[model samples]
Target: MKSLFKIIIITVIFTSINSCKYYNFTGAKPIDADTFQVNYFQNNADLIEPGIERIFTLELQDIIQNQTSLNLVPQGGDLLYEGEIVDYRITPMTATADQRAAQNRLSITVLVRFSNKNKEEDDFEKRFSHFHDYPANEQMIGARLTAGLDEIYARITQDIFTESVAKW
Candidate 1:
């Protein structure tokens, strides 16, 4: 009886492992897609920050690569991601008693066009955005700026990933 139970357990594990192609714990099921492509995300915002495009492009690539079992290809992939930075700006978030700015919000928005060759109905174009707030006294530059940008990019990329792949 012990030997039979062990056989059953092994079979269950094997079946679970092979349940689906490109199955992952992140709730992404890429179906028959074996490769993906992320084209350069150009920064077209009026207030462009140098290298912001590169930062966003690389981070998106990294997230998809880390979360899915798909090869990163230069182009013509089963899954494709291409977009442009549409907005990058800082606006006053709060005002002090003296009528001076007390806090500022740095917001970034991206327009993405995602294509799934294997699933034509699944292709979509969407806008993803994120923001960070800082004290009005602090200049929106240097390390603080980089940190804020990084945080914003992380959120945007995660949203893109969740939409393009994660069914959840």
Candidate 2:
């Protein structure tokens, strides 16, 4: 009876492991894709921030690479991501007693076009946006700008990853 119980537990463990071959904790479902490419994301926003295009492009590439097993390719990858920074805007979010701005929000929007060579049906074009809020008294430059950009990029890139591969 003890031997039978051990065998049952071992079989169950093996079955659970084997059944999760296609399951990724990150929720990425790249399926048949083995490689991906992120093209230069040009900054087409009306309020252009210098070097943001390069930074945003790298962020997208890094997120996909870090979360998935897909290799990065220069071209002709199984998955392709190309897009532009469509909007970068700062707006006053809250006002003080005197009607002065008390808080501000920095928002960034990216238009992405994802193509899956292995699965045409998975292709999509969408816009992902995110924002960071900070005190209105602080100028959006140097460390403040970097922090806001970092937060915004992290969210937008993750959303792109989810839409393009997570399939959740």
Candidate 3:
């Protein structure tokens, strides 16, 4: 009886592990293709932030690489991503008792064009945007700027991933 119980437990464990072969915790669906390319993202915003375009491009590539098994290629990949930064703006969000700004929000918007060579139906052009708020008293430079950009890019990149591959 004890041997039968052990056999049942081992069977359950093996079945569970095998069933997860195609499952991705990030909710990314398996693709028919294996390679991806990310072109340089141009900064076309009215307000230009130096190096942000490069940073954004790298961030997008990083998320896809970390979440999927696809290889990154310079060109002629099974999947392609290209875009431009459309807007970068800072605006006041809330006001204090004195009617002064209490918080400032930094917003970034990117226009993306994704092409799937293997499945043309999955191609799309979309805009992803996100923002981060900081105290009105603090300047948006150095570490503050870095943190804000990181937060915005993280969300925007994730959204891009969901739209392009995850289908969620």
Q: Each prediction's Cα lDDT score?
A: 0.92, 0.93, 0.95
Candidate 1 regions exceeding 4 Å error are 18-22
lDDT per residue (tens digit) for residues 34-141 in model 3:
999999999999999899999999999999999999999999999999999999999999999999999999999999999999999999999999999999999999
RMSD of each: 1.8, 1.2, 1.8
The count of backbone overlaps in candidate 1 is 0
lDDT of 3 at 86: 100
How do the candidates rank by lDDT, highest first? 3, 2, 1
Residues 1-168, model 2: lDDT tens digits = 999999999999998888667677788753788999999999999998999999999999999989989999999999999989999999999999999999999999999999999899999999999999999999999999999999999999988988888877
Q: Top model by lDDT, which number?
A: 3
User: Per the 3 Å backbone cut-off, how many clashing residue pairs does candidate 2 have?
Assistant: 0
Ranked by TM-score, top first: 2, 1, 3
Better of 1 and 3 by lDDT: 3
TM-score of each: 0.91, 0.95, 0.90
What TM-score does candidate 2 get on C-alpha atoms?
0.95
Pitting candidate 2 against candidate 3, the one with the higher TM-score is: 2
Q: Give the distance in Å from residue 6's predicted Cα in candidate 2 to where it truly belongs.
A: 3.1
lDDT of 1 at 17: 79
What's the C-alpha lDDT at position 76 in model 2?
A: 93
RMSD of 1: 1.8
